[model samples]
Target: MELSELTIHKAHELLKQKKISSLELTMALLERIDACDEKIGAYISIAGEKAIDQAKIADEAIAKGNISPLTGIPVSIKDLICTKGIRTTCASKMLENFVPFYDAFVIKKLKKENAVILGKVNMDEFAMGSSTENSSIKITHNPWDLSRIPGGSSGGSAASVAADLCLASLGSDTGGSIRQPASHCGVVGIKPTYGRVSRFGLIAFASSLDQIGPLTKDVTDSAIMMNAVSGYDRNDSTSVSVDVPDYTSFCKKGLNGLRVGIPKEFHSYKGLDPEVDLAVKNAVKTLEDLGALSVEISLPHTEYTVAAYYVIAPAEASSNLARYDGVKYGFRDMDKKTLIEMYKGTRSQGFGDEVKRRIILGTYVLSAGYYDAYYRKASQVRALITEDFKKAFKKCDVILSPVAPTPAFTIGEKADDPLTMYLSDIFTLSANLAGIPGMSLPCGFSKSGLPIGLQIMGMHFNEEKIFKTAFNFEQATEFHNKKPMR
Candidate 1:
């Protein structure tokens, strides 16, 4: 196997055994990115020299017997996470030249573990779209089928991992950004329970719904990445004071005594692709055969997920993104003389169409005349959605569903229709809305050979359960082992 394709655990084993040095592994990945990233368009910035320097330091640490699972691993980062001295664009022209003075909480954790960061990958501009074509920077193509979208907001993160450009990546999930893309790209992506991982440095789209997580080649790697980054943070008010468990320990647990919930509403949803439906049903049967109890459950409010999410997410985004006027650190229109003109001109020129559309919708919803009619009602629906998940969890240990309604569609297929694009995240928005842990991993493939993802969600702070379930299924199937042809 190519060194660039090695999982974090495997690479750590080789590094600790002196079979390979961090420099060699890092270089192998850099070479892979150099050779393949052009066609994939997975990266917005490449930090080759910095990664080499970090790898050298990691090798020295390994020699001193200070190695961890990620000590010598190479990984990619979503561009929205702030990295000190590295340009953090958020895939928007607004912050194209912006560099952070400090690292995000997750980046600090990764650095402490001596992980080498290859570069910042692309995303939907301000995380406002379902397809990466919304990126003002570049269009990240699916490695499985170059003509199709990899999926969005975290498209580049998933694409890089699937294409072996990087072993794993860090991505933020707000309304299914992480899992949908992971499904489209055929990789493992986890969104820990809200406040499980610190969001201190993440560029916020919807502060209440955003959670930082990992995208990896397999389930074990996902656990390793989660272990390094999950913990209470004094810097973030929303971060809960909870003990972080050893996620890796749960990976070996079999499916015996596990209860998996299948939501009736999801299976009966209109427009679900037959291929995806078959794959998920087969996955449920496979779980049953492995001694897991499959129970039909109801999250009756599931039908309202898409409508509720759009209103709540955009409302939060409107308030959070208001800081990007001309006076801040990002782009400013100096050509305008009046202050208001500068503010208007900067935002008009800086943000992309999707971003502007969301901002306008958000602002309108939050206005005095409409707040009671839109944002307030959405908040009520959000509470109901959370209640729905709470009720469903009482009946099962974990919930299983398709990550997306269909396999990845070709780029531009739904770009002109924002409502259709929002529906792409129907299966995933509930987890984020309820602030619970969720994951996406390969279950099967579409008839056209595109990948299909199976989602496993657990109660808040119960990532161990999700990991145990995902690992068992991954062991039984070869879906995750299949790589995209470059």
Candidate 2:
């Protein structure tokens, strides 16, 4: 296997045996990025020299016999996650040149483990769109087919893993950012329960719904990553103080006695693609064959998930994004005569169309006359959605479904229709709404050869259950071993 294609587990084994050096692995991936990233548009910036320096440090640690699963692994960070010295653009002109002095909590964890930081990857502007076409910098293409999108706003993160440009990556999930892209690119992406991973330096999109998680080449790699980054941080008030388990231990071979729930609402959606439905159903049957009991469950409020999410997420986005005005830092419009004009001009010129659209919709919803009618109602509906999941979990250990309604569409296919683009995340929005753990793994491929994903959701903070279920399914099928022919 190519050095760049090695999973975190494999790389660690080789590195510990002195069969390969961290510098060699890092160089291989750097070379791979040089060759493939231009065609994939998976990165916003590449820190070649910085990455090599980190790799050298990792090698020194490995020589000392002090290495973690990720000690020398090459990993990518979604642009939205702040890195102390590296440029963290969030794929928007608003902070296009911004650099932070402090790393995100997850970055701190990775740094402590000596993981080589490859570079920052592209995404939707401030993580506002379902397709990466909303990126102000570049549109990330699926490694499976260059003509199609790699999903978003973590499109770059998923594409990098799919293309073997990076062994694994960190991505923020708000709505379906991480899982949707992983589904499209045929990789494993997990969104931990809200507060499971600290969000100290994550560029806020929807404060209540946003989470940091892993996008990796396989389920085992995802587990290894979760061990390093999942924990509490004193800096983030929203971070939970719960104890994190060894996620890798959950990747066992059997699913005997496990109960899998099939939400009637999810499977019955009229917009679901026939191929995606079949792929997910087959995944469920594979689990059943492995001794899991399948049960029919109802999340009665499922239909309101999209509406509630659109309201709550955008409203929080508007509030969180208000700090990007020209005053403090980031891009400033020097030509503006007054402070107010500067704010208006900078935001109007800096943010992309989708970001502006969400901000406007958010502002309108949070406006005095509409707050009680829109935002307040959405919050109530959000509670109902949460209740639905809580009640469903009473019937099964995990819930299974399709990650998205369809395989990745052509780039620009839904660019003109905002509503259609929004609907793309219909199956994924509820998890964020309910603040639960969710994951997407490769299940099958479409007739056109695009990858399909099977989503497994567990109760809040019960990632181990989801991991066990996904791992069992992975071991039973060859889907996780399939790579895109770029």
Candidate 3:
């Protein structure tokens, strides 16, 4: 197998046997990025020199018989995550040139394990849009079909892994950013339960809704990444103080007694493509054949999920994004005559239309008179949504559904209609709103050859169940083994 295409586990085995050096593997991936990234537009920046230096350090450690799963593995990080001495642009002009002096908690963990950072990948501006076309820097096209979007705001993260530009990538999910893109790009992506991963140094989009997770070539790589990045961190107050299991150990076969819940609402939803519905239904039968039981379940408040998420996410985004005024770091308007004028001018020139739209919606929802009408009601509905998941979990171990309504759509299909774009994430928004773990892996392909994703959601911190189920399904099918011809 080509070095760049090796999974994390496979590469580590070869490195352990001294068949390959960290420098050699890192160079292979860097070369792959160099050759293909122009067409993929996966990276916002590439840390070639620094990555080589890190790979050398990993080689020294490996020579001394010390290594980790991620040691010397070339990885890409979504631009929203901060890295010390690396420019972490959230694909917005406001912080296009901003460089952080401190690394995010996840980056610190990856660095400690000696993972070679291939640098930042692109995303929607401030992670506010469903399609990567909202990115101010560059539009990331789907590797499957260059005419379609790779999904967003983690489009680059998913595309990078799908195209083998990087072995794996870290992507933050807010209202389905990670899973949706992974679904569209035909790769494995997981969003752990809220607080399962630390959020410090993650550029805030919706503080309450955002959670960082990995997008990889398969479920095993996802587990390897989970093992490396999951755990408590004092830097983030929301970081849950709990034991993180070795996620890799749970990538086992046989779902003998596992109960898979199928929400009727999702399958019956309007606008769902027939191919995606049939794919997910077939996946359910596959699980049944594997000795699993499929139970028809209902997340009763499912219809309110999108509305509630839009209100709550935007409200939090408004509060969290208030610090980006020109007075502080990031882009500034030097020609403004007054402080207020400067703030307005800088933000006006900095943020993109999608970001400005969310900020406006957020500010409006949080306004004095409107707070009780919109934000407060949304919060109440959010609680109901969370409770619905809790109740559904009582009937089954994990919930299974389609990740999106359809496979990747054309680049400009929904760009002009914001509501249509928002609905693209309907199946995924509930998981984020309820703060549960969710994942997407390739299930099948549409007639036109676009990939479809099967979403598996676990209650709270039960990511092990998600990993196990996805791994089992992946092994039973050949979808995960297929790659887009680049």
RMSD of each: 0.7, 0.7, 0.7
lDDT of 3 by residue, 249-332 (tens): 999998999999999899889989999999999999999999899999998898888899889998899889899998768999
List, residue by residue over 1-486, the lDDT tens digit for candidate 2: 899989999999999999999999999999999998989999999999999999999999999999889998999999999999999999999998999999999999999999999999999999888778999899899999999999999999999999999999999999999999999999999999999999999999999999999999899999999999999899999899999999999999888899999999998999999999999999988999999999999999988888899999989999999998888879998899998999999999998889989999999999989999999999999999999999999999999999999999999899999988888788899999999999999999999999999999999889999999989889889988888885
Candidate 1 similarity to native, TM-score: 0.99
lDDT of each: 0.93, 0.94, 0.93
Once all C-alphas are superposed, what RMSD does model 2 give against the true structure?
0.7
- Compared with the true structure, model 2 gives a TM-score of 0.99
Tell how far residue 84 is off in model 2, in angstroms: 1.1
> Which residue runs of candidate 1 sit more than 4 Å off their true CA positions?
none
* Tens digit of per-residue lDDT, candidate 1, span 236-317: 8999999999999999957898999999999999979999999999999988988899998999998889988999899899
What is the C-alpha local distance difference test score of candidate 3? 0.93
